[model samples]
Target chain A: MGATFMLGELVGGLRRNLSMAVSVVLVTMISMYLLGLGLLAQRQVDTMKDYWYDRVQVSIFLCVEGSQYAACAGKATTTVQREQLRAQLEQMKPPIKDIFYESQADAFKRFREQFKNSPLADQATERAFADSYRVSLTEAGKYEVVVSTFQGAPGVGRVQDQKQLLDRFFAFMSVVSWGAIALSALMVLCAILLMATTIRQTAFSRRRETGIMRLVGASNGTIQLPFVMETLVSSLLGASLAMGLLWATVRYGVGGYLSKALVDTAFIGVGDVLAVAPWVVGGVTGVAVVTSWFTLRRYLRV
Target chain B: MILFDSVTKTYPKATRPALAEVSLEVERGEFVFIVGTSGSGKSTMLRLAIREERATSGSVLVAGRELRALPDRKVPLLRREIGTVFQDFRLLPGKTVFQNVAFALQVIGKSRSIIRQTVPETLRVVGLDGKEKRYPHELSGGEQQRVAIARAIVNKPAILLADEPTGNLDPATSREIVRLLDRINRSGTTVVMATHDHEIVNEFRKRVIELDEGKLVRDQVGGDYGTTTSAIPVIRLDEAGEPGQAGDPGETGEVR
Candidate 1:
């Protein structure tokens, strides 16, 4: 019964300080939403790294006409040169895992697909690109060995390892993730200030009520509980709404938009949504509760 | 119900103690008036009795417990047994009279069913039977004091401490409020009123504890409202002394 009375007080208090309460809710929601986005972005980078890092290959481009390398000999590479290169890769201690030969037609087709919307797409043709041998090593570290052995031996125009490119890509994305986190940290500080001000106002406006409660022999905890619960309930409302909206955004916005837009990329799924919900709701609610309780402890004496 | 054994309370920066070696004992179910001018330690005495401020360099015993040794957390429990009504009739503005009266029970963790049953009855006893829904501003000074009184007694505390309860009321309203307190005292609840009103003290014959500069100058049963440094031609001072000194005299205005 006493619990019910205190609940009534919480509800009444929320209604009485509706504007301040709404400010707390909105601030908490926005900040926590950003926090959730940061976490999700970090998770996305990790998954993308795991997926892409293993499949990355080093492409050994064969010499074409007018290639610069002395091994090219100012003419296209012959089939015998290609055969010798294949034989050398197969003889390694841990054999190279897979190899795919991309004809000039294949390279030009891939280039067009990759730069589908670029202005250069209409300007490229088959002869402008070189035919390449895509070689996957058992370990990506073996690229150094391949580059050393085959650099100027024969018909090798360039030895480019995809791992170098992939590392730079992931590094840029990690920076983006950290930037999101830093932005969210700033927003969280804003959220804390908003909640503290709201609680101070509530305590000040209800100064008479709390004073009377104190005179009537109420415990300090009893007097403080309603105000704490008021902030708690409202922030929880906002955080859960943020979580719900975050889930929808992840499910429909990121998944739907990025999946069809980039087919080779592995997008986060509904399971990731569930994995990240608790941190958003729990973290935001915890901050709001603590801020409110601390404000009341300082500003409102029962 | 209350005993102050040489209690002295000095504020943090003050030169002299607000109360200095003041000793007084009020038994259960007695009406004792603590009469003094402003800053004469009347309110300080009440605050100490309620354990609002700790007594410095002395012991205060209330409801059979030493207040100076009492833990801060249990001070609320001690306060729960003592009802305090102040001069301003400190009713919460947004709450109704019933809520104000029921607030005491709620503080003590009483159930809603019990508060509903007790508040209306207590308000009716204070002659506010049908005005339970009115806010404090809607009530007169006498009515507000009645509500404050109702709030004070709703818990059926062993003692009711009133600090200038009638200070804001007119003379006639003061008498009515005093009569209500008399009725409460007649029902065996100890009422300690701290006031400067000489009329109520002269009109109603009870034990009056008059303090001058934090010192107990007079403790008299059937005592008059002594003027500053002079005794008045009112009720004679009965040498009731303490409870043990008076030999457990049952009530006031009896042997006199």
Candidate 2:
């Protein structure tokens, strides 16, 4: 009798507030979806950083004749300075995993090949280019030691770490991820408030039943179980909708479209969606139960 | 079986007490009437009996259990043995009469078979057997009160506390309700009623306990409406609506 009566109360409550329950589902779905995306974006940025940072090469541009850099001093690098720089780099082995030298003609050839479609390739000369050494570090993150050692040395114009450029891109990605997470938090607050209002209204409308229940010796738990179950049913629906939408987004949106468009970058797949699905649903259920419990405690008071 | 040992109750932000140093007792199987005008603390006395309100100084005992020592968690257990009815009927509007009465047992965790058997029998006892499927709004005022009464007595509570059960009914309907109460009382359930109807008080001539300004002024055996109290004018029963005209079909079944 208790179970059937409780079921009756739950079903009747949801039917009475069908539109409000739908609103709760929609709001919870959107918030959980955004939260899932934020988590996946963070993972995507981490994967990309690991992939590109492994191959980042430090470029040490050697001075050419007529070069305007103060270190270059309008003098072309002699064989001695060139050989000395190479020896210095070779001695720094272990940290310096590999090194390659490009001559003036090689630099000019590569420049022309890279800009073949540009008009500047037609007017460029070998003297306008500079020879350089492309150094690959075993630990790409430790490029600072190599850069400090090479800068201001004779015949070297500049030492540029490729990691700096990648830093800016990853920073922007982090901002996007964190910003989505923050917005998801705001929407979650809205969902909680909406659910509280829904429970409060339902409790108020059924106060007569509750009062009679109290007079008839119904315990507080018995009076509140139906209300809490009402919120839980709707929130579970919303959570399931959220998980389904997230799976579809990762399966089709990221795996199908994004992976094909950006062929080289690794994006989050459906597996990551599965990983975050439990957290999203668990979090939403927890909030719904707590909010309903509190609202009923204040309003029903059985 | 109810006892009030100098019980005093002062509500928050009130100038005077609702019940002040008043004491009374009703033995088992007795019909007791708590009478006075409005603000006589009769409702407060009932609330204290049900442990809905705590006494400010003294203690209240119902069914031989001191209510002050009862924890809030155990209040429901105390209430299950004491059925209560009010003027408003307090029926769940959406539920049918059977559901309304069955709800009392359902809340206390009665089984389905028990509910199925007990509900119809209790409805028959309240003279509402055929109207089991009717909702509250579909019934007349007297029938609605009957539903409330059925719900209250369905659990076979030892004590029945009625706070103005017939206040909203006409003279004829009120007499029928009082007759029902008297019949239930004859079946060995103690009835404690609070009312302003002088005719019922005088006609039934039960033990009347009158309260004046939160103080017990009169306690009489087989008493009528006395002269000191300012009572509502008695409405005489017409010939067509005499007391015996309302047939008693419920006497065959014992409520307990």
Best by TM-score: 1
Which of the numbered candidates is closest to the native, going by highest DockQ? Answer: 2
> Model 2 over residues B200-226: C-alpha lDDT tens digits?
887899999999889999999998756
lDDT against the true structure, per candidate, is 0.82, 0.86
Model 1 CAPRI rating: acceptable
Interface C-alpha RMSD, model 2: 1.4
Clashing pairs in 2: none
Pairs in clash, predicted candidate 1: none
Residue B256 lDDT in model 1?
A: 32
C-alpha root-mean-square deviation, candidate 2? 5.9
Q: For all the predictions, what are the DockQ values?
A: 0.40, 0.56
